[model samples]
Target chain A: MTTFRQFMSSSSLSTVKDAGTSAIDSLKKAKSDPSKPPRYSAAGLLVKGAKSEEWPRVWREHDLKKSYDVVIIGGGVHGLATAYYLATNHGITNVAVLDKAYLGSGGSGRNTAIVRSNYLTPEGVAFYDRSLSLYNTMSSDLNLNVMFSERGHMTLAHTDSALRTMRWRAEVNKLQNINSSVIDPQEVKKLAPSLDVSPNTRYPIQGALYHPPGGTIRHDAVVWGYARGADHRGVEMHQQTEVLDIMVEGGEGPDGKGRGGKVTGVKTNRGDISAPIVVNCTAGWATLISDMAGVKLPINTHPLQAAVTEPVKVFLPTVVVSGSLHVYVSQTDRGELVFGASVDPFATYSMKGSLEFTEELAGHVLELMPNIGRMRLLRQWAGLCDMTPDYSPVMGFTPVEGFLCDVGWGTYGFKAGPVSGEQMAECIATQAVPKLIAPFELARFERGDLVGEKGAAAVGH
Target chain B: MFGTRSFSFSFERSALMMLVPCPHCGPRNNSDLRYVGESHARPDPNAVTPEEWRAYLYWEDNPAGSLRETWYCRAGCRQYFTVTRNTATNEFENHPLPGNKTGAVDPSFHYVSSSVSPSVPTTSNAAQETETNS
Candidate 1:
């Protein structure tokens, strides 16, 4: 089977032709039933001259509305999923999701798509576990094949301290009813025989925190499914719509810091959108967007670079992570070895990958598995990570009235996309911070009550 | 002869290296240095509220453009120094004289282990300009 990248590269002409034909057919069908959500199933293969080539557009184009009940910035997984949950769960369908560029073009497209809930903190574990559960039923929920391969996830511990921390994490995960435990190196080898667990190497594998339910999934499909579901529920998905500024009505707020100023609407590149509620779901540019609403967040944007090698035989059966080496590697369904590293030391908005990153990444991967040193890197890319000092997300209502935030998701945002969306929707609907995400509020910083997941974060998640 | 000459240059892609102007070692590749993040003056803990303290500890300018930052010369002088660099362009402003710099180096800048030997500043303004433009 060809990889998604390969198919896109090799069959551009045929794909475009198929898309054009299918678009025309769908447009004709839409005229008969305007409310019909585009169904993309296996039945397309039955048609003459068709070999499962044509699929309906995942989302429809939408014009900018003068006003919306809620306006969500950033058409990533979080934004689309928030819109989806708000419509389905809360009956809030008059929502508009605005994106500066194409959907899922930010961290949603750039993440390695590893899903797991083996976090250290209780708040972290509960929150991410909820996300993992949502991902478990996501394929059926959205009627889209998300391809969530639950092969398992193993985090290798190289030192005594790392091993101790793994045990701690295992206990924490177990308390949350998550099937996670610390396993011996022998058991680790049994799960993934390709791993170099020998003691001869530098920082040899002491043991591993094995979580059997954690695995990888198709990230773009998740985004598309949520977007489709949201659009089907009458939520507007506007692409290439950049939000320039957030209009705020200055007033004495409950806090009396002028934070009571209400968010009137937002001025976008397309046009002005009058929204009662404006949600900042932009990851990397979260601080910039929040600053426009007169809300300051403790977020530093840094680039996290990742690279994927040419597809080889699927020898690696599980996701392998080494926080000591500052690298994580997992093989995709199409056999490409996806590798991720820690965020860049300095803060920058530039998504340009550096040669230093490639060099260091190769060296670190070689340290973990010397056999794959010959694997040629296909391509390298970088995505901005909004690194919080405490390494946790900033969610819930900000000081600016009606302006909510779901940002500061440095590395693990992709894993927690669903839960963040559901909880963010709840927060917006009820105007009350959900218990699961209460500890992650923007006010936590002021109260000096931080949920520091820096131990499990910073490098691998 | 057909139109005005537009000087064009082919850009070479490599490691995105920043030039750190070290007092003892002069300018060096960024790989040989360690970034200490944006330097901020510590507030008086006794007087400030928890909010102010948290802001001082966690809040960062994180500007996309030029700013003064602290960097340690790990491979060279083994000294901490402050340099003005454009984060977006990765361009280092040349400090003409020692006195014109950000005074003494920040002692808080921590060094990372590196084997590279200290070298004199070899980067030129024209090279940086070319890099930024490209």
Candidate 2:
């Protein structure tokens, strides 16, 4: 029997009143009936002759419902993961994920996909380690190939101050049981010989912070996998449905001036959804979403630009980052050199690629590998980043009741997607903030307790 | 240092430069300048809640289009000035003319000095006394 039918059979008594017995039986037949197409697999690939364009659809489309248990905004990694965990972990399948555009069209698809846990702060290190752990088993858990590559990651330091900060990060990572350490220029050159580690360069390479368990993954696959898993568990996925505004009923909160408000529902382009609990999981447009609920955020939206070079020989084995240059480079399995830089100086919603960005990117890349200067860039693109002060994300419950935010992701949201989903699901299911993400509450800023991650996050992600 | 290779063939002329008007030295490329963050007003410390204080310290307007922001000309006559630039197009709508609030010496924004000489004194009493005597 399918997992959905098994769940239906186990929980039939409770759901019989709200969801009719006939409806449940029909849904079960839709999943378990032999007429349904087979699932994708290596053996199934051969049986279908590999050109299986006629195969089963990865996920089913559904009509919009008038109400749901939970309404999640932005069908990106965080939103989909939360819905997936809510169904599989908490047995809450009455969820709706709404997105203005197609899933993963935002930062989930734009990031360089470098995953690491070598952060400077203890809170950051612990949080990212949990994310890395979840990513390690995601393929098996989701029954989809996420293609997580744990090759390694190295952050090169070109100045004395940069090297000192790398040492600090290494120590913090060590306390968390993460495999991180500082290595000299000679060792860095040995690991990635393409790097120009010679002292004759404009900014000589001092050393690098190396983490053995850090590497890159296929970002798009992660998005699709989570979406498929969530859909399989009966979470409704709504695309091209933009949330116009969030409806909040007034009440008393921490600051008595209209702070304590309850989330009634959301006004979307499709129609109004009367959901008791609403979550803001959008990264780039987080501030705008929060404002709809009358909750202001300390977020600035900036365009973070990135580019990919034409397929070269697979040369870069590890993810390499240069803090001094504000650039990170990684080689995909398909052999394209992916490059990402820090967020643009000013806050803007426009995703227009700047010539200044391309010029500076080429200069920085050439500084690291002078031999590859001739390689042409295939195309350049930009994605919006919701930057927060202290460079940490805002997660958990807000002052508004029933309204939660998992935003201010800035540049590293893609790396923390799975863990954020798991924790946010727990927060929503239990009506209490999990301890793992308690320090990241929105009220922490009001309490003068900020988890500062700027020293480590100022560079490329 | 950036390369000297000509970019004449790659892109349009307007996109090549982020024209930052320097009060002391006319218009210059944004690469010749440094970006100071949003010029937000700090709240009085003695009479506010942590929430209000944090809002002052952290929150930003961060508009999508035109907004007034502060920038420093590091390559030219090192001075700080404010100008309105469209965050979307990265184009300067207002120029940084002379006698405009050239608060380069403003005590509130001592960027280099703040990092160089930290608020806390590092020298001991003996060294302080010796320096006083000298």
Candidate 3:
């Protein structure tokens, strides 16, 4: 079997060695006694409530610094989590996270919050399973209640091909030690009683891939937890600060057209701040951000719309998905049934919600659960997804020096946030792509070594 | 119980309806057309390098603003044509007509050059220009 380490060219290996030396030197210079946040505990909560004391701000507002060791582009879960890990795990605290809007204003706040690891590919299953473990421990680690409801996940199969794919995914997941299996219609009906599993229904449920260790999390809490944690550890969080362009020297005439030089700094709306490294964590605007550095990515931005019905009694027990129907329905703790379909048929940056989406979503959701036809939709909105040719993400080093990418997540970036941040922090500190993410390098596209996850990624989240 | 509550429908009127003008057919709902992706210039096969070939095949200038893309009138004329649209607003520019190669449909509208062109000839101002020039 070929290993990911074997795929690394000798030139990149030499670069890693050079970077390792600098990384060690920087680590030695980093502050050893960074300030910590106020610990959250039952005793503290009781004391505060008894004393009628107000809780402090979750994160502090910081003035734009002249320079930093690293600059992260987005303040979403990926960026904030990376900052948190860099501060906590690697002790690299001279990091600045810049966002054009408030934290969690983009895809971080908009995802369906479904978390699962029952993937078809071994690489995908292993990577996402690690994320699942991280999420399992995230609430306590962050000292924030992420409300992780591990109420299992189900992907229904309406056809034989879909069932065969589910079985293949189950076996692959099992080989990776993930708790996933193919269950018959009777079992699925038992799990989700609201589903119309009767043979008379349109696209009757045949079977499903049942994964017990999958469910949803409070996405906003995850973002806030990471932000507060990173902020406490001397990492700066800059909101409403838009990055205008990236400064690169000796790279195809400063246009980022060719890939040879290093990033010097970033020009933002406030001012130009110098940094040795810049990480692009912006999802919807991934292509635009990378384009500023002249590193072209094979990514297109498409809007994925989702809607929520009015709050009612919580009837749905588990997260239900159907790829053929192009819809996934999951009820929130607030008792609102959140519905999401596949991305719009065409690529456009516009995020306007359409009545057509609601109409079709109503039809599909009714087809799956005939009893929900009368449920009134309360609100609908859209978020941008940076889709790659292969449904998997593009992580780690790009062709340009000192510029790293954690983009091309498409529709499933939220669930992988924790692991992506942990690995990205490691990558930034060590200056080398980790083995787990080496298969997802941007150069893979050039080499035609694509990690195809369309089977599991599309409409499954 | 379903009939007891009167539906209070409130949605964006503009986004709910979109009209795409097909050259063969009159203006119709956008659902009548199939959206082809951004147009790209295919590299010359005989002289193209591997990197160039791959870049042409995969790399996209996915601009957030105006983009020139192809659309097939699947439900209308069953023909393909190019239109310059602002991706940010989902609005088409200058009432684009098919087979207008001269790209001066509206003198005020500037054309963004793309490799793909409409093969079908149609009655448009550009066709009249061709006739007059010939």
The C-alpha lDDT values of all candidates are 0.79, 0.78, 0.80
**What stretches of model 2 exceed 4 Å from their correct place?**
A1-38, A50-53, A251-258, A458-461, B1-17, B21-27, B44-51, B65-68, B73-134
Q: Using lDDT as the measure, which candidate wins?
A: 3
Of 2 and 3, the candidate ranking higher by DockQ: 3
Best by TM-score: 3
Pairs that collide, model 2? none
The DockQ-derived docking category for candidate 3 is: incorrect
> Candidate 3, TM-score vs. the true structure?
0.85
Ranking by lDDT: 3, 1, 2
- Which 10 consecutive residues of model 3 chain A have the lowest summed lDDT? A25-34
Q: Compared with the true structure, what per-residue lDDT tens digits does model 1 show for residues A1-461?
A: 99999888789756766776785576568658766655654333333235554544667888888999999999999999999999999999999999988899889999999999999999999999999999999999998999999989989988898899999999999999999999999999898887788989977999999999999999999999899899888999999888888888874533222377889899998989999899999988887788778787888777788999999999999999988778889999999999998777666666666678799889878877888878999999888899887789999998888999999999999999999999999999998999999999998878888897977762542
> Model 3, range A1-461, lDDT digits (tens) per residue?
55667657555666665655554444334324224435666555554565676666778887999999999999999999899999999999999999998999999999999999998788888899999999999999988899999999999999898899999999999889999999999999899998999999878899999999999999999999999889878999999899988998778755644488689999999999999899999998898889888898988777888999999999999999988787899999999999988777667776777788888788888999999888999999888888887788999998779999999999989989999999999999999888888888999879778898988964642
Clashes of each: 1, 0, 1
DockQ of each: 0.20, 0.18, 0.22
| Displacement of the residue A121 alpha carbon in candidate 1, Å | 0.5
How accurate locally is residue A12 in candidate 3, as Cα lDDT from 0 to 100?
Answer: 61
